[model samples]
Target: MIEHRRIAHSLVWSTVALGALALTGCATTDKGGSSNLPTPDAYAELRDARGADRGRVDIFRDSSGLRLEVVARGFGPGTYGMHVHAVGQCAAPDFSSAGPHWNPTGAQHGRDNPMGAHHGDLPNLVVESGMIGRATLHMVGSRLTGEGGLLDADGAAFVIHAGPDDMRTDPAGNSGGRVACGVIATPAG
Candidate 1:
């Protein structure tokens, strides 16, 4: 039973969600460098677009890292193959049943392989039908959130494939079909 929540903002949405979670959780700036992060309008605004198969994925973290913003719609335009697997249970028809890819640094599977894979091997999402298929993935060498995350001791899930992550496949991105999914909870910043 892993449950953590904390999104109640009031101080101007908590100073714009803590300045977009300190520019996507990269907050270390004291006149250092690499600090222009701020983009989390709860996945960058894009209200329910008439159930074009539904969409709205917003996962956040601060100190400058981990950000997702899949705001799909009707799923139609191009590219899909997304990643972030490793259980959260989204069973039913075809959520690929949600179960693999959140490789907590076991590392391998593309990004130029070395064997050890799975860090939600992301790279493929372009939807644009009625207009909504947006993606803003950025987990490069991630820790996920405010305290070293892959969901900090038990938490993670976000899959949406069906094709396009041929990032040198091994555990995923043979990208054929998994359709849609989401369960990256544990943020309340």
Candidate 2:
């Protein structure tokens, strides 16, 4: 039963990903100069320090909130910490250019902390054998462009850590070094 459910879920996400890919080339802005709402969709191509393709991240906005899915490959099998960084720049080697975690509300790190669980806090990502990992249906209850929303003037990014998040440590949940990074941006950009 669990296997069946997993298959169904994978199929659903694959379809949605294909849909996003189909609309990737379309204009996301009010290009015609009409009263069209801005499409709050974005994508990111993850890369390792050596500039190799690590995977991709797709973010979709809905009425309730934002949904993000991460598909990763070519990494060691282990649980790793993931978060949305404040800056969009994902410089190679260390990716410190991505800046700190997105915390508009000034909350601390980790969901397990009493005074924490900031906006950028996300569930840990687990990679299994064959260098495959998928973190699907991560709901980020934040807007794309608005007060306290992501994609600010500095933009945002997603980072994959070298170790699992302790889920209680301040600042970074005691997660290890960053292994992969991706700059989040609209497909049209």
Candidate 3:
């Protein structure tokens, strides 16, 4: 009787451990679904057109979704438009050359915009008098992947403007110059 009780207790504990493992596994995957996105090379900071030192951006994926954090410096005061622009090039002053917003589904601009919403259209970034500013944004699209977004291929670039992002403008938020820009190379090592 004693041996049988011990075996039953062991089985119960084993079952509980397996259940916990399953829960943890589910929590680590992306919210929408399992991502087939490739493993990113290494996270790299976006450089301004002049190659002057700008800021850095990092993207991470968890069970909830994708989180992008930007830490930049040397930007003057006033509100600036920050977003993920199409194409990885930052050669032009306006990033208009970077292509349209990073909208895979062809959505409009702004989170509040009723017309259309672009996947890459994020709120504006406000920089105080200081040289440094920070912005953190989140997205729940299943398309986000370490290889790039699940929808678009080539990849995308993060851009910082010199003016505020109206969030409803056609191409960009009518944001001024593309002061700083970084290509979403890959996840951090």
Candidate 4:
């Protein structure tokens, strides 16, 4: 009788542990089913025109939406406009090489625009006296893979402008010139 009681107690604890693990696994799945997205991926590297490491951007997928964490440094002390550009090139002096904002849906520019905001529209980054800024953005209607994704064939870039985004103008909200740019890429295994 004593041996049977001990076995039963051990079985109960083992079952509880297994149940917890199953719940944890289920929490990681996406709405449709299991998620195929990458977690904690260093998807992009930002740099200034002088080829200095200004920051890095990480991409992660969760049940809520796609999350982007932008860690920046060595920037002017003010609010700067940041966006995901269409191209991956970052030509120095002028970052026109980055092309325009990522707008796969043909939407108008600016988050405040009544027409629509571009897919790459993101909140402005505010830098203090230390010249550092960090922002975590939750992106809906976007993904890290598949069609119209950030990691698409042509690739995408992160662009930081000299001024704040007006959030209501077409073609870039008069965000001024691109002060810094970073191309998003997948890391090697």
Q: For model 1, how big is the CA root-mean-square deviation?
A: 17.8
Question: Best candidate per lDDT, number?
Answer: 2
* Model 4, TM vs. native: 0.76
* Candidate 4 local lDDT, 29-87, one digit each (tens): 21223445444653677778788888878777767657888888888789999999998
lDDT of each: 0.61, 0.84, 0.69, 0.82
* Model 1 agreement with the true structure over 13-40: per-residue lDDT tens digits: 7899889987777664322245554434
Candidate closer to the true structure by lDDT (higher is better), 2 or 4: 2
Q: In candidate 2, residue 178 scores what lDDT?
A: 86
Deviation in Å, model 1, residue 42 alpha carbon: 8.9
Model 2 agreement with the true structure over 131-150: per-residue lDDT tens digits: 97998755557877888888
The best candidate in terms of TM-score: 2
**Global CA lDDT of candidate 3, please?**
0.69
Those runs of model 2 whose alpha carbons end farther than 4 Å from true positions after fitting are 1-40
Better of 2 and 3 by lDDT: 2
Candidate 1 similarity to native, TM-score: 0.27
Clashes of each: 19, 0, 6, 0
Off by over 4 Å in 3: 1-44, 92-96, 146-152, 187-189
lDDT of 3 at 1: 100
Residue 91, model 4: lDDT of 85
Cα shift from native, residue 95, model 4 (Å): 1.6
lDDT tens digits by residue: candidate 3, 1-189: 999999999999999999999886656321223444433332337567778768777576656666766778887777888878777666655556666667777777776688856778777878887878888877666245543473256667788877888877776778877778876665434
